[model samples]
Target: MRKLTLLFSILLVSLVSAQTLQDSITFNPQQQLNAAQRILSGNYGKAVTVGAYGEVTYNQPEALNGELDIQRLVLLFGYKFNEKTQFVTEVEFEHVQEVFIEQAFVNYNVAPNVNLRGGLMLVPFGIINEFHEPTTFNGVERPSVDNVIVPTTWREIGFGVSGKLNNLSLGYQAYVFNGFQSTSFDGEGGVNGVLKGSNGLRSGRQKAIQSTIDSPTLSMKLDYYGISGLRLGLSGYFGDTQAEDDVEEIDGANIGISMIGLDARYAYQRFTARGQYVHGSLSGTEDYNNLTGKDLGSELQGWYLEAAYNLLPQEKTQRLFAFARYEQYDTHAGTDGALARNDAYNRNDLTTGLSYHLAPGVVLKGDYQFRDNAVSGGEVANRLNFGIGVWF
Candidate 1:
């Protein structure tokens, strides 16, 4: 603990010095180093940083299995073209077998207050949607509501402008990307119901791999961070979901999908709180259900609230923190007809955990998850999980 405190003091002092240097950069950019130049003085304005993190877990519920696996491995590549432009990309390996290009974009600092960014990018909605590096958030597993509603790691092909004025931050991104593919919809339970409203809208992702698009979608996000320790946001998505032109349509009817989200975060001293709510609606579901014979829900919604506190005071390096979270979500909030909404669609989650950080971006995680649903003959899924993650 003594060593940790000393390290934190040194870091704090360095940060103050850096801030002072930043204030001086504006007066003499041609002769002095900015934040980026200080890090790579002889690299010809080109620089790259790499990071990797993963999780291993065990679950004991009924006869469920325990497994140790590399959950996520990633490499981030960045290059500065000049003072105004840079290229960034993230190459990811999931479960060690799945490969994904999570992000690839070029950001241009057009002015002191405005910037333009383009290419495949992560959508900004809830807190986790964009800044979900493991060390940055609480809990061994991410909040279920974010996974099912806001859809963590959600990315698409598009471009937009991001800017800030004093305390207010604003961003606009419009993506022309393939909408959900209807083929992925199924009425299964436990993570398979991405389109069927049983597991939310996850499986519908096209991931830009030989994707098909009949009508592309437009997604937008607007957020604020105008106050210290407080953040507020709103985001939405709209598009036609029909992936095939030849699918049989009832009276020339098809479904257009829409989703809206609201989220907030606040912290005071040692106490921190965060929450998010997202709701989705589907159009022409009755006709589409009749034609496809798949029990698809027209409505989906989910929400979660979390709070945490640190055990050490005025310390930023190493400290243990306790947290608790409550989550409720239903991918199948409502159905078309004749079929009642599946009880399994609704889930209630309670989690309590402790996180200990050895460094700012490296930590050990442990948590217990208690999950309940109204499914007939289905046992409640409650388990304990622990893991470690890092970022730099």
Candidate 2:
């Protein structure tokens, strides 16, 4: 695989170089975009960018309890198809155990006013839903609400459009993908019972939970960036998730999710302020009776807010930044019937950290966090973490 990748890279470089030579012989500012595409050999220049991030988190369940562990590595790559089209990918490795491709998509610019993308793309549900980077956020970590309910970096198969009018940027996307499955509905109990510990619920099977060829999900997003360095967005999704020929006879799951987000930064004289908020709910039927019977749905919800400041200004070469964040979520909100009865359903986390720049595209960071589990008998969790991140 590595050899094949290297060969492809070399071929692409050769093509790009040839095109660049031709473009130099016939250069025109008015036709720069077209020239770039031609030089790229197709529509865009054969360009590639790569990035990676790694983190380790420690949390103590209580003052006396030992720390729990959380860690991950995230990598991203993009291929420019032109000014109008690109291919992007994101992969994640959890606990240094295994790697999974989180996102892989092709984006096409239909017009200056419209665009379309498909493949395994982010679900476009909430503000931080699509781009949840640890260093990018204000706090030591993302919000609890985002993790449990809105589910950041959530993706499915779909397509949509985005563009600019005047000073405002407008965008939207619709996709057909898998929806959430209920634990109680399929004898899985709840996310808390099934995913964290026992795996009784059929929902435990993330690999099995996918959109069938016959039925696909739909999701969309609307975003604006008219204000200098300020971004505002809202998104929603509705979908059906059901298994075929299952013993439970569960018909399908219905879900409605929504979120609003705001972000801004002023990089004058080496100072910056950035923040984002996202809230959403998950509702649908679960196989409770183990007989394909539907039950009252649960409300899963969460949100996060953060802020950051750069300690050393105008020293991009010697990077130094400080940030903090608070996040919370409840997986079993307002559910009537269940084996757990909302117990072990709530989580709150607070994090603060500092980062140092190792190079133009590299960084090292360390942080500490405090966690609370309202449902887990008020257990308190805390931990320290450090890691590295880079982009090229």
Candidate 3:
């Protein structure tokens, strides 16, 4: 199996490289969209670029939690079909065993300020959802708020448009796509509530290979960066998650989901700060819970704030930063049905860490976490973590 996988990977890389070389000659350094335009126009020199990233972690509780791991590895491919059209995709391996098509999309330059794209694409919800890239953020792991609220790494089979108002430093992305299936809403496999613990919305991702469209979802994002090193944005998502499936007296499960989020990032001198807030609700969840015999919440929320400063501000090749973050989230707020919301459902976490940069895209991190859960005795989950991450 391993040998076959290796052979397949080698063949895939060769195919992409050969195609890119035949279509384009150069690769201009810029954003994905701009690069797509140049590649499609046959103006770039490089046929393709290949890179990967990985993170390894060690924890205080070495027996069950602490171990070496390849959190993720990715192979990115970009190709130009013509002057106005291009294609890009990301094939990712998770935990070294699972493979997925993280992204696969085609782009068309419709105008100076607009581009249209379709296929499997990331959902732009918060800072980390679309631009995670590991090296882009601080700490060994992504923020907790992103996990339960905005839900990073969220993608779907969809069609969308994106463009920028360069003069105003404003950008926008909006899309319409197929939504979640009620079948992924079963009550087993450690899934809790009318939805799922892993995110009732995220678990149902059709992943682009095959998608169910009984329910359609709409998502939009508006971002601004008028000031140097300062960014602000707002995003929203709405959809009917249940897909109107045929289930006896389960009409109530055919519910609606609405979510809104706000995020900000700013940097000045050697100091930096970031924050994000998200809130959402599901309609008909109360009745839906009764019909499914699961405890699902109607209201969900998450938020986080972080600050960091470079200790070696004058160093050009290396940097040491001290950072702290606070996060809060509730996955079971306003749970419907007979099962009341567990106090432990609301969680607060504080993390303090030091990150040392050995070079651009290479970092080592150490952190200690303080945790507080509304449920009794939940504080025992605190631990210390150390990790290294790199990308090229």
Q: If scored against the real structure, what TM-score would every candidate get? A: 0.81, 0.69, 0.85
Clashes of 3: 8
Clashing pairs in 1: none
lDDT per residue for candidate 1 within 280-371, as digits (tens), equals 89876676666556567888899999888888774455767799999999878877767578888788899999988777557788888888
lDDT of 3 by residue, 119-174 (tens): 88888898887656655677777887887666667888888899889998889999
CA lDDT scores, all candidates in order: 0.67, 0.50, 0.70
Q: What lDDT is reached at residue 31 by model 3?
A: 27
Highest lDDT scorer = 3
In candidate 2, how many clashes are counted?
A: 25
Q: After superposition, how far is residue 189 of candidate 2 from its true place, in Å?
A: 17
lDDT of 3 at 134: 55
Worst 10 residues of 3 by lDDT: 24-33
Off by over 4 Å in 1: 1-46, 167-176, 184-194, 248-254, 376-378
RMSD of 2: 7.7
